[model samples]
Target: MGSRITSPEDAAARTAPPMRSQITAPVAKMALSSRIVGRGDASFDGAVNIRVETSGLTTPPIVTGKVPAVGSMITEGKALLEITGRPVIGLAGVLPMYRTLTPGSKGPDVLQLEQTLDRLGLDPGTVDDEYDTDTSRAVERLYEKAGYDAPEPDGRLTQAVDAAKAQVDTARNRLRQARAQLDAAKDANVRDTSVQQGAVDDAEENLVDAQEADGEAKFKASTPLPVSEIAYVKTLPRRVDEVKVERGGTVDGVVMSASGASLVVTLKVDAQTAQRLKAGMAATLDLGEGTPIAAKVRRITKNGNQYDVVVAPNRLTPSQLALLRDANVRVTIPVRSTSGKVLAVPVAALSSGSDGGSRVEVLRNGEADLVPVIVGLSADGFAQVAPKGNAELSEGEQVVVGR
Candidate 1:
């Protein structure tokens, strides 16, 4: 039956604009988008600027070899370069290798070394600070594995050398006693006696034995390498950032630069933002031209009012890393994120109701129905919401965005 608008109010209501218009498009019945995002400005310092320096050495060392390839990521327990013909192993540590370490040496440096070796599968016996025999053996194995020779003051050979010296001392004592007896007989005017003559002969033979023993003891193989010859770092598995010297070049201090195992992206933040950062927190790195790379918070350092946070990439191919080095890039971090996708609508479509609760004018079958919804986070002009009552709303349903 055709109905007529009997009153002006009815006519005005019927003739008024269909609260909103709808257009058909080849789109989804249900769509999801980000509800919250965090943005920040990041000045790319490029890849780590590495100027390889010689691990502390007292004297200038000649670079006998450049063991690691340039731009190579040096993993844990590896050498960065050969200093004075010996590889200066790079380990992760804050303390510098101060003194020359030998067998029986005890200190923080030895513990650092043993820990690095053990982590690399070298098994330096116990991880104690003492550079004992086991540590020496492990160090040798490490050197051999790296295709280099272990430095001197090695724990393995020191004991053998000490024992040899002790034998020489005993031989010398025997020779001294025999010589004293011969001298006494000669002084007593027994020059005509065969016994005195025999004593003299025995003394001469003992002296010869002692001399030979001393010569053999001193000739025993020993390492003249000083503790200073080895370079120590605090951590392991670092990447070779730069190579400063080539083979035959003098390592007068600088050798090469290396970064820790994880490539870090350093950024500064205000106190408010710094509070949000934590180790292992996730972030996004945008280099402007390419897709954003994923990263995690590695560390944060606070110095006075300035706070610096370090970030690391979850994974990056060699080519990707090559392209990113020193490249000016931007990074974005999401301060808050939802566990999963949620229903969201334009904030403009939301309006107040008599009860002061939030509601959206939903369009259904050419009619306007107001449905109450609970509001959550609002970002990018969209607010996360859920049906407040029995009112039903589904994804892709038409809702009035504006008057």
Candidate 2:
């Protein structure tokens, strides 16, 4: 059976309208999409930008060796490039290498170097500011792992050490001769014995001076680290973004640029929206691949009237990462949600009553009856509805949308 309806104008005019129609639809039982009021959609305009600057220094400053490939991940204690036929290694440290480090050198830079070496299992002894013999040996190991030879001390220093050793040997020989002479003079005369004893004492003192000189010379002859041979990076395992120097080109200014290995998505929002967001909040990333990826909020910063939000995606497979390396994507964060399923109806089915309360028309036994309802949430052209007072409403029920 079909439903019937009468218009107020037709009844008041004492005339029947030529045509009247009615339509019907069923109520929907589903979840309603809701979001925080005053919030807008967030999207990434482009890929993450890399801006970290790095450079190398050498005597010739010429790139005569292998360079890291662009987009490669560089780890700690790995060689970044080759300069002047020597490998320039990258180590983890906040302080930059400003001066050449050598034996007997002591400072905060040396301490940082020692810490880095120990982290790499190079065994820099004592991990102190003073670079001693153990530190020199550990540096040698560092160079060995990089497939290069450690720089040697100056030739003049090695020659001085040799000369000092020779002087000590001569003094020892003289002391032995004086002792023999004293032994012979002891049987001859007391005055002769005293003179020989004085000669022996003088020879012993000369030997002591020569030995001290030799010790100083040896200290100066330990291994040395040139400023150009090492580069200290604040973080390890960064991705190579740009390589400015080629194999035959000369190094000038910034030689390379790198940043964090993992990619991040950035977007701008209003201050109110930013306040609702915090670090580690879950989000969905849409790369336009027909599937959404999981992501989280990394940080939020203010810029002028707006705020910038950085989102980090979960660990992506190599293929997925490569596919979306430099592409734009959309992100969606849910700020509010319904607790469970509820009866919902199209917004058109809802109407305001004389009491200013919401109500819906339900079709029952070919009769239209008004059911007073309370609207919980309205979104996406749908409104969540619950029966008010004694009125009854359930899922899969037919409702009159028009008459």
> Lowest summed-lDDT stretch of 10 residues in model 1?
23-32
Predicted candidate 2 versus true structure: per-residue lDDT over 1-403, tens digit per residue: 2345657875777775656666767888888766432222333222222212223232557778778788787788768887777777888888888888889999999999999999999999899899988889999999989888888787898999999999999999999999998888887766646688899999999999989998888988988887777877777778887788889877665667777777777778888888878888887777678677787878888989998787878877876676567766677766655677789998889999999999999988878889999998887778999999999998888887877
Superposed Cα deviation of residue 137, candidate 2 (Å): 1.4
| Candidate 2 worst ten-residue window by lDDT | 45-54
Q: Estimate each model's TM-score.
A: 0.60, 0.75
| Whole-model alpha-carbon lDDT for candidate 1 | 0.65
Off by over 4 Å in 2: 1-58, 187-195, 303-305, 339-403
Q: How many clashes in each candidate?
A: 18, 0
In candidate 2, which residue pairs clash? none
TM-score of 1: 0.60
**What C-alpha lDDT do the candidate models reach, one value each?**
0.65, 0.79
